[model samples]
Target: MQHLLSRSWTFFIGLATGMMLTLAGSGLASKPQDSPAFQDAARIYSILQQIREFYVDEVAYDALVDDAISAIVSHLDRHSDYLDRNEFAHLTDVTSGEYAGVGMELAITEQEVTIVNLFPGSPALEAGVVAGDRVISVDGQLLADSDAETLLMGMRGPAGSLMHLTVQREGEPELLNFALERRQIDVKSVSQRMLNDATAYLKINSFTQTTPQEVATALKELALAPQLSGLILDLRDNPGGLLDSALEVADLFLDEGVIVKTRGRYYEANVIYFANTGEKISGISIAVLINGRSASAAEIVAGALQGNRRATVFGEQSFGKGSIQSLFPVQPGEGVLKLTTAHYFTPDGLAIDGKGITPDRFVPSQVVLESLLTPIINPLPLNTVVAYQGEKKIQIANQDNQLRTALQALDHPD
Candidate 1:
């Protein structure tokens, strides 16, 4: 569905209003408008007037204008969009990495809204919400027909607000219910743990505003452990977020080089991001893991590191999403136009728009890894109950093939 708000919308409204005022003051026999700008404006103004005066039924003029404005931007590209007030607010919350909600990431799976991830220290995680749980309803409202945005809007609200949630879990005979309180959730994008005595693992969910700092903190904490010789940077399933966050995260392990470059028609969009003089974690081999779901900023990081010979990327080809979206706020507290502005390139000047980063070593199947596991740990838990942090690391290492391969590569670097 098309939404409303654009930078051009303000100028459009002004032009239409001016034309209407002029038309009202002057007679119908006034000379035809000579200027091409005036001619186009008059044509649009006439149509709007016709709709208001002769349409089959009465329609909200502002709503009609909003829709018209949205229609104008929708033709540009799939990524460019006009965000209405509510959507603009949601975008703000996402980029800022703070919102009042139960703090679970939801995805559409088999035509149902399913829980995919839970932020640490979140109400949903504490309430025993696990991945693969399908949402049935929120506060007694069924979500069979609700889109992800609608479901998110239903889930989020004022802090301290109470909400009832219903979900269907795998291997469970009955549906589960939880009374959850919406709290101010500060999303932690970087999750890190020591894979072994010598290897550190970092999983970046998305490149949020606070992600760079969170990554730095994780590296520092991991550094405290003895013999941290290797680092596994996991970007699998990361859909990417803020571009600056991605650049900073890539810079953390790089020492003086072009991290990534962007090129577009606009001069502001055509620029290169360079790493500073020093690396935070030196003398450590880095392994970056990516899959088909990894995209945008995640690809930027992988490309930068791969181009610089700083890390070996592992797994399937990444999601090719390199176009940049620049948000133009149309009105205060109203909405914004998310316009596609630029295309991203790796440090080596390889464009990543449609061509994703190819992994250095591609492992075709997780099933193969499953077969290789010892019988003692066979039959991994179908629905993992949140285990102790230490046990969780072991489970993660055993369950993911890409991570296991990266760990092996880092441990026995040739």
Candidate 2:
């Protein structure tokens, strides 16, 4: 109670004094504080006084104030949130895709922070972390009740600093503990490999500033292979990033067309983008893979390519987050407010907010895919059926239904 009162009173007093000084300079300080111009401000102060005096339980006044600000912003949309100074700094680091940390890719699954992937040369990878590992604790703090954002906060640190992680892996009796030193890890958003003799696979984990160049380089390298017949652009489980990066990637394949259009109440927010003369991979047969986790910029690429009839979209529907968030800077070094300025549409004029892009060839993802793709069925005992709840047992050549279907489609493209 004392702490809150001291902090709140200190800040408001200074702010009030500043306003008074400014008004005095304008020769308006002599006006009564109860005047119409100051009515709402006085009322807010009165409410704050009442809360400090009569509230049953002591509350952190600063936290209450920030919560009020967040609540006001929450009325806007689900994607909008309040960011204090620290969170704003973290946001910058995240969008830049460069930070001093372990470089573990995480996904929130049923309120649990689970590892989805890891950067190739990351501290977490060196510490022996793998996909599907559930984070149980961090630095001795249990993560069961911790939110994903809070867990992420604990993951970052200064370079050379050490952090501990405990994870639960399937079929392992002992929990895996890692003591890792933080390093400057640049998350690679693009990965490429030759899937088969004639097909190349390129997986974009996210859209970052360097993604377009990385993709172009990958395509050029793949084109040099004499056996290359098709390319698979995988965006499955990709939570998207920069819109401009996605536009650049779309331009690599599209010759000319409106890639995406955005509309909003603000005059400046309504805009459109069209592909220019930079179609480097126009003649190559391309297949895009998507799932419920693919969103935002990923959706932009999928929608653009699919709308332009440049690629065959495969896999499940995408995660629909078709909105443009513009960051408005506050006073220097304070922070920035990320507000959704416009709702974006596909080139074909479809606004996919809740309804994601439907693939041309829809294959069920995850466990369902395993079941459908695993054509080699084991014979069971007569008059008996047993259920095994564990890791997947089947291993087939074309076990990935989406990839297999994509390969087949590429092989038989008309």
Point to the candidate with the largest lDDT: 1
Q: How do all models score by TM-score?
A: 0.77, 0.77
Off by over 4 Å in 1: 1-42, 53-56, 107-115, 132-151, 162-179, 368-398
Minimal lDDT window, size 10, model 2: 1-10
lDDT of 1 by residue, 271-382 (tens): 8889998899998899999887677778888999999999999999987777777766666666666677777788888877777899899964253222213243332233
lDDT, candidate 2, 1-414, per-residue tens: 000000000000001000000000121245577788588657777887789789999989877766666767879865554556766566556545677887776655455766766778888888799877888988888887675555556666789988888999997999999998888877677889886777888998766567799899988887887878788999886666666777788898888998888787877667788999878765678899998777777788899999989888999988776776655544455444556667778999998677778999888742332342445421211122223337654332324667777877787777
lDDT of each: 0.70, 0.68
lDDT of 1: 0.70
Model 1 weakest lDDT span, ten residues long:
13-22
Per-residue error for 210 in candidate 2, Å, reads 1.5
